[model samples]
Target: MAEPTGAAAPGFELPLLLFAGFRSIIDDLHRELAEQGHPEVRPAYGYALQAVGRDGATASEIGRRLGVSKQAAGKTVDRLERLGYVERADDPQDGRRKLVRLSPRGIDVLVRSAEGFDRLRAAWVRALGAERVAALESDLRTMASADAFRLDATSWFNG
Candidate 1:
């Protein structure tokens, strides 16, 4: 490995640092989820579940939301169904449409994810100080794109 030259990091380091922070938080969250009885949980599941939402969505809708093909969304739905995270229901408005709704287990994972994120934020507060964290968040909010919180990022990244 090369030693540090004591020079400022390359421009690429900015995005790398941001991605590393995201990866660290996600890794931590998955570890907690596995320990909390969601051992099969994966990041893709979280994104798909979010796309499904409590109101439910069809595979086509999910595909659009996820920025993936319908077949890809269907495959994801198949896995989620087998894992008991979601169930298919006949759409009331459209007889031919099947809505993929979250099962109780699916809700549990979302709940747990929220709690885990809260705990992680608290840890960040402790490590970086609340004000610094808050400022960082503020700066990110200002710098981030309007669609930064969109659910298609994972699929977009993969593509």
Candidate 2:
């Protein structure tokens, strides 16, 4: 028996490639976080911390920024709170909302992680040559900013 055309081959190879790379990066980050005494911390928590900002953010705002639901954002915040990486305080202007901010421990972890990222970035730059690396970054950013590619990208500052 012959197979049907559409069902004969699985498509979406390009999206699968993207998914593989994304998953690998997350895995690497988890390994690094484990080494830093934060085995429980996930990449989502780091992203949430970055989005929370200095003034802090409400769960709804975090959900919007992270492309998650408010309930999910609140759950993530709760996990971070248990990890001593974030804290929730009363939002002075709104009794219904609580402001989520990085705790001192969170800041320390973020700084350390950033330092590690910078070091790895420098290695990549050296391996690729500074000029080539710069050009590659620019090209990637341009592609990411294009209408056709922008929707596939997660953040404007992703590069």
TM-scores, all candidates, are 0.94, 0.72
Task: For candidate 1, give the lDDT of residue 62.
Answer: 98
lDDT of each: 0.94, 0.74
- lDDT of each residue in 1-159, candidate 1, tens digit only: 243499877778789888988899999999999999999999989999999998999999999999999999999999999999999999999999999999999999999999999999999999999999999999999999888998898888888
Best by lDDT: 1
Q: List the residue pairs that clash in candidate 1.
A: none
Top of the candidates by TM-score: 1
Candidate 2: stretches off by over 4 Å: 1-29, 146-159
lDDT of 1: 0.94
How many steric overlaps are in each model, in order? 0, 0
Report how far residue 43 has shifted in candidate 1, in Å.
Answer: 0.6
